[model samples]
Target chain A: MVDALSAVFQRPNFLAFVIIFLWGFYIMVTRYNLVKKLVGMYLVQTSVIFFLVSISAKKGATAPILLSTTDPVHAINYVNPLPHVLTLTAIVVGVATLGVGLALCSAIYRRYGSLDEEEILKRLE
Target chain B: MSRHFPAILFLLPLFAAISMPVVCLRHRHWSRPISLAVLSSMVVLSILNLNSIITHGEVRYAFSGWSAPLGIEWVADGLASMILVTLSFLGLLALVFAGPTSPKDLGGRIVHYYTLILLLISALTGIVFAGDLFNLFVFLEVAAIASYALIGVAGGRALFAAFRYLVLGTLGASLYLLGVSYFYAASGTLNMADMAEKLPHLLNSKAVVGGLLFMFIGLGIKMALVPFHAWLPDAYTYAPESISPILASLVTKVALVGWVRIIFWVLGAKVIVNDIPVLLLVGILGTLAAVIGAVLALNQRDIKAMFAYGGISHIGIILIGVSQGNQTGFVGGVFYLLNDAVMQAALFFLAGMAICQYGARTVEDVGRIGKQAPWFTGVLIIVAMGMIGLPPTGGFFGKWYIILGALEANNYIAVAAVLLSTLLTLAYFVRLFEAIFRQTPLPSDRLPSDIPFAYKLSLGATSAAVIMLGVFSDPIVQLLLNHALPPGL
Candidate 1:
């Protein structure tokens, strides 16, 4: 348990990811402005992407690209390419989601003439 | 050509969705027929694919000639093909039912609407066929974006509802992706079958458990299971008339299929049910949703809101079946999934027609519908009866099978909850019936006889199906669902 705790502390990157995710979630839950809520959502998405990317990183590893000069590429010498590829796909999905979200927000704004979530709900009620 | 069935099934609607606007610009009247042609072709392909799966064993198609486990593959075993056929057929019927617009004021947006509808269908098809987790996420986003635009196209409170749905739906998708990342990190593969192979070995790993939890919560929100169901009522109520029926029938149902695949296939039921409390938790949540959804629905004035809440209640029943984790329970759950798709689509189509015919939005307005449009009201009564689980409706058998499964599992609470929700369901739908048949008259719009014939035919077809499905359920149960499900449930 102590070793696990020390390991977690040593890897602050993982801790930061968790904190950022929670913070984004908090904003999404509490914020009344639609734009802010969407921003929170984006933060949450990016944090997950970062966490996934971090899992593929090995200390002192080079980029996934092979160097012919270094002949005979070793697995340990380069970062794993799979997570990068996966996250790249995820990033594109995230951006598409964000674009759609912003478009929806703009539509909401045009209709209600305001972007406050609670205010809109109150009016709807 | 047969080998390319999966690609043809998904790509047809996709290319059609893309070209809809251009087709509309050239000849406006051609857009709807073009969409119908694409969807009809997809239905034919999916049916052929399902037939192949049944006659043979599983049908597996790898994209770009890539091999399995390493390359993405679309495999229709038992379950996936069943859903593929149901979703595509429902989509085709709903598009047909949408009929031609008046071509007056609403003419401009008709092309866009059909485009989004076609895109949504394409996304749903892809979601069901995707063998890789990341591929599922991509399709999920595509579906989400299309639905958002579809909802907002109605242009009023629908915009707000779509926005709210977007926020929650995006959050759900992100959580699901994050969960996939954990699995990928642990198993070094995103293909579902590969993940399943690795999952048993990693049962004790915290990352695996965390991933499961994240996915469960994410999918629950997406499916609008209790406590995460706030957005569904409005989204369903406020969406464009033509779009609601398709979304009602297919969207959440496919999402549930995704959930089942992840829990029972990818993660393994033994790990999910034995190693954790997910089964019990879902069962309890389902019970809560069942009761709460029915009670909330009882108070709703808007017809669509009532159906949306009722949808939540039925989802709970499906959860109970899954929690049982026995063959009978899986069968019951899968059967209920099929029944709900047909019945709910029927109900929503009736609701849309009522709104178009008389601008009927509430129960009071609906009361007048019966006196004016007897044919529409008659068909609606059958759907309502089905919703309330009356005999000779497909719904009754689904509940019957579920009750038997619950009894077999010795989960009396689930059994009791199922029965109680039935009563609650009857209570609410009966109120609608009373308003339709018994209530005093009120002034309402009476649509002219010029109302499109296609709308009535669609409603008639689905209503007839509800009864036929109940009577001829044995063949379907033996053929489609029994084989469709993964073995050893």
Candidate 2:
């Protein structure tokens, strides 16, 4: 168990991803405020994005720039660019979701005058 | 031009959606005509595409001349084209229902509504045709975002419902993306066919197993398979009248299609069924969803909410069929998917009409509806019988096949669940019909108003299609579904 913990801690980014993801999930489930829930959602998304980006990283690697001098066969010299590209798309999706979430929050506040989930449910009733 | 049909199947609506706001700026009346024209053409193209697939084989098109495992690919196999036909046809009908009524109901926001409708349809098409996991994720998000706006367009309790849906939906999508990432880590490929080819060797890899688990949970939430169904009832109930039919019939079905693709096509049946017991888990949960949904549906006074709960039960039945992991089960699941789409759309349309004509809000409020609109009430009775899985309607055949599949798989528990849910469905519909035919309408109830020609056309066509599907189930399965079955199945 100690060895496993040390090994997991060695990969700090993965540890960070796990911790942040759990934190976000915890907030999302436990928070009463809708905005806080939205924030938690954002954090959860960010952690996933971080994990994706971290998976692309390699030691002693540079950016994925192919030139005439670079050997295509030894691809480990450069980080995998695909995950970066995917994370870019994921980030855009995350932002779009955040914008919609915030808009809904404001709309909910306008009608119910509160962003607390319980209060809003009471108003709806 | 014909060769480009796969690309144009989705791009047409997407381009039209992008140009809609600008086009509607001056000639607002043109929006309906343009939307109808585009959707009609889509229905034609989808039919033609299905024909071509039937004649030749699966059509594959890589964007900008880039092939698989390198760039994005779009595939229109037998199953994809069939779903495309269903979505585009239903989308056309929805736009028709929304045309005359929306301008009155939505006021100035009608243009935005049309745009989002087209966008949603386009994204759904993209999902059906997607050959890569990342592309599927993007399209899923596009469809989801469009639905969020569409649901919240009514702006009251609807906004809150949309918010709830948005939160849950985004979480689901993110989990899906995470799953894709894990798959990518394991296989180093995002193309589904390539991943499928590669995944067998890595079946025992922790990353692959984790990915499958995440993907199933994510899609389970998206498809609202009972435990994750908290977001569905309110969202479907509070959506604008015209939008509810489309949401009811298509959105969750499309999500289920995604789930089916990943599970059956990418992961393969042997792994899910024999190796890991994922299918067993799905089967058990599906049985749970079927019973729970029916019980919840029986208690709902609101008609749309009741139908929404019933939809969950139907989805559960479809999942139960698919999870049985046999040829008969696969075909039954696929057939139920198609049949339920038509039945649910018809139910919602009839409910909308009742709301429009008699101001009926609850099931009880629709009392004596048969006295007012005899023809529609007749259609409603047929549809209700279909929902109860009676013979001569499509729903009966779907349930019949699923029960047969369960028996074939020796899953007596699933067979019992199907039978029990059918009885529960009968109970609810019997109650609804009693309210419709037996009770007297309140004196303050408004006189029945004439439904629009569009409503009559769409509803009639859908109900007719339901009966036709039952009558023609054999040919459909033989011609399309058998060919669409995955190799192992």
Candidate 3:
């Protein structure tokens, strides 16, 4: 248990990912403002993206650029590139989601005259 | 050229969507025809793809000349191709039904409507064909984004509903991505087939288990399996008339299919059923959804909301079949998926038509509809019978197989849920039938306008397909579903 705790503490990125993710989820569930909820969702998505990018991280590894002088077989010299590529795509999807979410928020605000969840529901009733 | 059909299935719509605005610039009236043409061709191509898959087995197309595992691929197995055919077929019918209706409903935004619909169809096709996890996630997001806009286009309470869907949907997709990240970290590959091959060796790993759990939660939210179903009723209720059937029938169904693929095809049923208690959990949740959705649907006054809740109930039934974790169970689940798609689409279409023609927005308002529009009433009765799981309807066969599977699995709770939900379904639908056939007409009742020929044709086709599915369930199970079954099950 001590070793596992130390290992988890050593990987601060993963720890931070978890913290940020939970924080975002809490805000998403607890917040009444629609825009704040969107912000929470954005944070949640980006935290996941952070986790993905951190999965590719290595202690002393260089970027995955091919070098003529470097030994190609020594793949340990470079960080994994796949997760970086995935993170880029994920980032795009995140931006699109945020854009859509904010657009919906604006529309909701226009129609309901308020962005608070309670206010909107009451008005709807 | 034939091998490229899977790529074309999605690319055709995507390109059409991109060009829809430009095409409509010259002539405002051109958007509907262009959309119809694109969707019709999609249906044709999907049918051809299904035929080829049945004859030649699974087709894999790698992007940019790269082989599988190194680059992205699209796989069209029997199940994927069947889903493709179902999606495009329903999409075509929905688009056809939307043609005359959307202009009046959406006013000047018809162009954007077609664009978003085409984009949604493209994304759905991509989801069906995606051979890798990340590709599936991308397609899922594209579909979600388009649907968010589509739902919001109604621009009232719909906007708030769309916002709610967006929040939950993004969170779900993010969780799914987190799960994918875990899988990637453990397996070092994103290709689904490769990940499957690597997963068994890593089955003991905590990351693998955690990944599976996250994926289920994420997908469960997307598919709106009860408890996670908070967003569905409002989204379905408030969406514009033309868009409701498409969103109601295809979006959630595709997500469920994605979940099945991940659980059965990628993770393998042995792991889910034996190594873990995931199937049991699914069975429990499904039973809850079945009972709860039916009970909630029983109390709804708004016709659309009632059908929306009924949709949740049917999804629960499908999940019950899926959770049984056997070949018969899988067949039942898949069959019910198809049946529910047709049934929900028909119900929403009829509801939308009733609203448009007679301003009948509630069960009480639709009283004596049977006397005025006999054909409409007849279709409603057929759909209601199917929903009640009466024999000779598609819904009956799906439930029959599910019950048989549950009996085989000795899951008595699920069995009771299915039977109880069936009775509840009957009770609610009997009320609808009584309203349509027996109750006196409201004082404000007026003669409904004649429905367009195209609308009638789509309705006729869907109703016929529902019965045909039941009549031919045996052949479908034998010829298609047997092949569609994943290895071991």
List DockQ, one per candidate, in order.
0.79, 0.85, 0.89
Against the hidden true structure, what lDDT does model 3 obtain?
A: 0.88
- lDDT tens digits, residue span B331-402, model 2: 888888999998889888887777765667798776656567775687888888788888898888888888
Report, for candidate 1, the interface RMSD. 1.1
Model 2, CA-based lDDT:
0.87
Residue A68 displacement (Å), model 3: 1.4
Looking at model 3, the pairs that clash are none
Interface RMSD of 2: 0.7
Candidate 1 per-residue lDDT, tens place, B1-489, comes to 666788888899999999888878978779888988888888888899888777777867898988888898887677888898889889988988777422321335888888999999999989898888888888888988898888887677888888889889988988988888888878889998888888778877777777777887788888899899998999999887788899889888888888888777776564554445566777798889888888999999999999988888988888887777677777777888888899889988888888876678998878876667876788888887778888988888878888887888899999999899999999988888888779656554545656677887788889988898789877877775557666456
TM-score of each: 0.96, 0.97, 0.97
Instruction: State the C-alpha lDDT per candidate.
Output: 0.84, 0.87, 0.88
Q: Write the per-residue lDDT of candidate 3 for residues B347-462, one digit (tens) a residue.
A: 99898888776677888777756568776898888888888888898899999999999988988989999999999999888888788778776556568567788789878988
Question: What is the TM-score of candidate 3?
Answer: 0.97
Consecutive 10-residue window with the lowest summed lDDT within model 2 chain B: B99-108
The C-alpha local distance difference test score for the whole of candidate 1 amounts to 0.84
Clashes of 1: 2
